[model samples]
Target chain A: MVNYIKLIQNENMKIYRRVGTWIMLSFIVLIPILVSLVVLLAGGDDDTTSWPLIMLESYFLFSLIIIFTVVVSSDTVAGEFSRGTIKLLLIRPWSRSAILLSKYIATMMFALFFTIVAFIVTMLINLALFGSTSDSNDLGGIVSTGIVGWGDVLQYYLYQFVTLIIIVTFGFMMSSAFRSSGLAIGLSIGFLFAGNIITGLFAMADKVWVKYVLFMHLDLTSYMDGGTGPIPSHPMTLGFSLGVLAAYFAIFNLISWTVFRKRDITA
Target chain B: MSQAPIVRLQDVTKVIGKRTIIDRVSFEVRPGEVFGFLGPNGSGKTTTIRMMVGLMGLTSGDIHIGGHSIRTDFPKAIVQVGAIVENPEMYKFLTGYQNLLHYARMNSSITKERIQEAIELVGLQDRIHDKVKKYSLGMRQRLGVAQAIMHRPKLLVLDEPTNGLDPAGIRELRDYLRLLARDEGTAVVVSSHMLSEMELMCDRVAILQKGQIIDVRSIRGESGVGSKPTLEEVQFDVDHPDAALGILEGQGSGRISDGLLTLSSDRAGIAAINRRLVEAGINIYGIRVKTKSLEDQFLEMTGSETIG
Candidate 1:
């Protein structure tokens, strides 16, 4: 267990010591603050809804997180192969699975760190610009009829985090399967947007298998709104979406581990 | 008590796609010995090293390090090994010290003191805190050696370690590797296309050609010097080369060129031929013994395949 932790630390050091990582982290905090400033400058602050309004406005910031997560995770494995550093890492005492697990865990930790930073910065800006109040209906259509509070805000972040986890894991799987970081990042982001469109198209087909598609369950936040997602007639409950996401998480991890462990590292 | 060989390769083979890259190459690296892997380009020296270090899977056979099979028990076997395949690539974003520290964390036995010692051993103490991107190629190579030896592994494997080093750097690396084998009793295995460098550094060398080991020669001639009478080319500069060749005809292999009669003879055979030539009224101007260098021997052994 201690050795595993040391592996994680080593991977984390490799990630955090890069200037690009720091720049990405700074953008995570900076972009949210900039969006809040733009909204305030547009004379949109006097209407003062609630804290959840800032969280809703910060939903776009999650896209930046997605970009950050995809870039970091894509570079984690593929960059090692491209730079030939995988040879050094592979000859160590640890198994390939252990080394890959450390990289995956470190990438997840980076995603979580960006999520937390986005949450805190968004919350602080919202409180400073528009005072926090107990107005239950101020969630601005994000939660249609729920009595939203800090608990709902926390739940919103949780759902977003879960969705981000799926995307990050998908990126990591691509990174492991491909040797080119550009290919991995391009394919991952392309899949992220195209997957939703494909899922929407599948929803119109009236087939039961549409529910099993990966992107159909990516937006766990849709369940928070208490409405049918993608397929209007077929409603997906929170438990069902969680279950679907869990299955994908498992499949992505399985592919990543198998490919990474069996890779020849010839370069 | 007899100690087991530090590294043993038993008929190790690797087949990629439909082609065999390495074919049943086997050798052992005893403790405190510098073993050299000599081969032409595409001759599978790197492939063999890759299999031994577990970078590439072997199609057949097994490699044992410290008595642990690399195929059956990888982690246990790899723990006793340190290797740099082709080039010692590192995270250029991290400082040299940070890179060592990162690698150090992977093994529980590697301590902070050892990391410091490795830095000192590589003579990187002055620039240990600098990022690897700022380091020169030779410095990076030294740092590579430092990381590989930080764990004090029993078997240290290097592939083409002298690729980019200058003369001074190469000499330094040669000295350091010899010191590692001598002081730490570590069995060092290195592969290179530089026959002269291998001749100066390695104690024993294995020559590979077309995915097979054709010969394993001792650089010190320990096996060929005292135990057996090995053939050497002796050139006799004589007053009449044709007459001298006539006098020494059929005794051994002889060829005359430019007033010099060259004979392939052992020490005793050379003495007998010298006496015979003088008695036959052939005045010898000078007799020069042309000891074949490693390059000549390597070309002669590998069918004179050009090394890239």
Candidate 2:
């Protein structure tokens, strides 16, 4: 267990040491402050309705988090192979699975760190610009029939985080299967956007098999928003969406682990 | 050297598609000895080393390190080994000390003092905190060696370790490897096409040709002394080179060139031939021993295949 922790620590150190990682992190913090400054400069109404604005800013920031997570996870394994560092890493006393698991854990930690930083920066800036209020307009009509409050706001971010995990894991799986980080990132982001289109197409079909499609279940927040998901007639519930997401998560990780463990460090 | 074998390859073979990258090659490396691997380009030296280090899978057979099989119990088997497969590729973003620290974390036995000692052993103390991207190739190689020894592994495997080192750096690396073997009792396996460096560094060498073990030669004699003379072309500078060749008629064949008679003979045969030549009234100017180098022997054994 201690050795595993050491491996994770080493991986984290590698990630943090890169200038690119710091730049990405700085962008996470800076983008929200920049946006807040722009809104204030543009002379928007200061009606003390800060929660809704903060949540909106956070939603925008979360999209960036998704992009950053996908990019970082894409680079985690494939970058090692391209750089020939996998040879150095694989010869260690730890198992191959352990080394890969440490990388996954570190990438996840990076995602969490960025999410938290963006959340804090957006909250601080919005509070300074528009002040705090207990109004429930921050729910943003995602929940139509509930007394949406700070709890729902937290749940919204949590749901976004859960969705980001699938994207990150998808990128990670691509990385393990391929040696080019660019290809992984391209495929992952392509999938993220293309999945919605595919889900929309599937929604038009009355076929029962469309319910089992992966992308149709990726947006777990649809259930939180009291919407019937992309397919209105399908009666998508939170439990069912969570179950589907869990299955896809398992499949993604299974593919990543198997491919990473079985890969030969030829380069 | 009666130490137990630290590494053993038993008929290890690797096939990629229809090509056999490594044939049924087998060898053993004992503790506290430096074993050299030599082969021409595309001869499977790196392939074999990769298999030994578990960087590549073997098509058949197994590799046992310290009584653990790599095919079955990889972690247990690999714990005894520290290897740089080809060039030592590290995270260029991290400093040299950070790189060593990262590698040291993989094993529980490696400590802070040991990391410092490895850095000092490799003579990277002054620049240990510099990022690896700022380092020269030789400095990177030194840092590679530092990381490889931090765990005090029972076996150290290095492929082309002296690729970019200057002569002095190579000598320093050689001395450090020797020290590792002698003091830490680590079995060092080094593969290189540099025959001269191999001659000076290795206790014994196994030469490979076309993915097969062609010859295993001891650089130093069995008794560890320079007394036992091997077969070499002894050059004799004589007053009358043609007359000296006539005196050696019944002995091995001889050729005269530039007033020197050259013939293949051991130490005793050279002594006897000299006496016969002197008695036959041929005054000897000088007799020089031209020892057959590893390069010559490698060329002869491998059918003169050029090394890359």
Candidate 3:
């Protein structure tokens, strides 16, 4: 267990050391700035605009997380196997399952970090540009520019962040299954590209279960605003999406460990 | 060598697709011994090493590392074994120290002092802080070795560890590995195409050919005696000398050639022939022992004409 933790710590450090982390985070921060500029130029009413909308806009770039997460997690095993470093690690005392799980958890942790930072940056910008006009204290209190209450904004970020976790995990699953990093990235991006199309097609087929698919429920912002399809309309059932995602996460990791543990390190 | 076999493989077979990459190979390395795995490229040397450490699954048979079965107790078995498959692969973006730290962290028992000690052991202390991408091939190999032994594993498996090294670097690595085996009792398994290098470093060797081991025996003093020629003298460029063929044919021991008949005879016959060739006015420009090389043995076993 201790070895697994150390392995995860090491895996996380690889991301922090790479230039990609800052590059991705910087792009994330830029999204809100751009959205605020557009809104300010158009002279939109502050009362109707919600910070959560900016987060929803960040979803377009959410595929970036998918792409990056796939690259990071796929390489965690396949890269080592190709480079011949798997020999070094596997000959160690640690179990194969532990090693692979550590890598998976580390990638998820990084995704969470990226999501939180983007959420905080967007929330701050939203408050800086727009003042609170809603009545309830939950929506009325503000730190600066009289924006929405910290509690409300925090809840909003949590909702988006949870959705991001599902996306990150799905990316991890794809990356773990594929050998080539580019293939992993492409397949993950391809899913995001084809997801709405597939979901729409499936939805139109009139299957009641289409709403329960994890991919269909990824857009939490739209779902949170009384928009309903797959995700439960009530905010209280937000844990359901998280639960389905956890099941996917469990299966993905289980397969990765089983395959990778017994995988021939041919390279 | 100690009584305990530090690493052992029992009838291990690794098959990829329809091809058997390593077929039913078995061997053992005792503590404080340098076991060389000599073979041509694609002859299953690397595959067998991969199986030894459980980096790959065995289609058949089993391997035990310091008494733990790789199939059933892989974690315990693997803990005592340190291996480098092809090139010693490192995270190019990380410094050598950081690379070691990462590997060290995975093991938990490997302390910072142990990482430093391993770095020093590989003679890379001065350059240990530089990023691995900036390292030379020799440095990378050394770093790979450093990572392997950081936890002081009982068995160290190195595959073609001297591939890109210069003569001096090869010598340095050889000495370090020998010292590690002697002083620390680490059993080392090294596979290489360089017959002379293996002869210089290993105590015993398993010569593999075409996914099968041709021979596994003690190499010490075995090459220079018993009319077994040196690997270096196996090749000879001869001018047309039909008379030399008559002399060899008369001797009744070897194939007659255009000029050179590679004779596998007793020590007395070899010495007598050398004297007879000189006395018979043959243009004996060169005469030397022709010990079978790892490549020659591989070709003979696999019946391959093209050398890998």
Find the candidate with the highest lDDT and give its number: 1
Q: Which residue pairs of candidate 3 clash?
A: A132-A146, A211-A230, B229-B290, B229-B291, B230-B291
- lDDT for each of the candidates? 0.86, 0.85, 0.72
Which regions of candidate 3 deviate over 4 angstroms?
A37-67, A134-152, A209-212, A225-227, A230-247, B17-19, B223-302, B305-308
Candidate 1 CAPRI classification by DockQ: medium
lDDT of 1 by residue, A122-180 (tens): 78877777676646444335634352456767777898899899999999899999878
Of the two candidates 1 and 2, the one with more favorable lDDT, higher being better, is 1
All candidates' TM-scores? 0.90, 0.90, 0.83
Residue A116 of model 3: what lDDT?
72
Residue ranges of candidate 1 with Cα displaced over 4 Å: A48-53, A134-148, B222-231, B234-288, B304-308
| Model 2 agreement with the true structure over A13-86: per-residue lDDT tens digits | 98888899989888888887887777677776443355666666777788788888888887778898889998
Clashing pairs in 1: none
lDDT of 1 at B43: 95
- TM-scores of chain A across the candidates, in order, are 0.91, 0.91, 0.77
lDDT of 1 by residue, B1-308 (tens): 17679889999988889888889989999999999999899999888888989999988999999899999899899998888888889899999999999889888999899999999989999999999999999999999999999999999999999999999999999998999899989999999999999999999999999889999988885645476787888899889888777777778678887668987888888899889988898888888888888998888887865643
Give the range where candidate 3 chain A is weakest over 10 consecutive residues by summed lDDT: A137-146
lDDT of 3 at B59: 93
Q: lDDT per residue, candidate 3, A122-229, as tens digits?
A: 767766776544433222232122224566555655665666565555656655566566666667667766876875676566556665676766655554434453
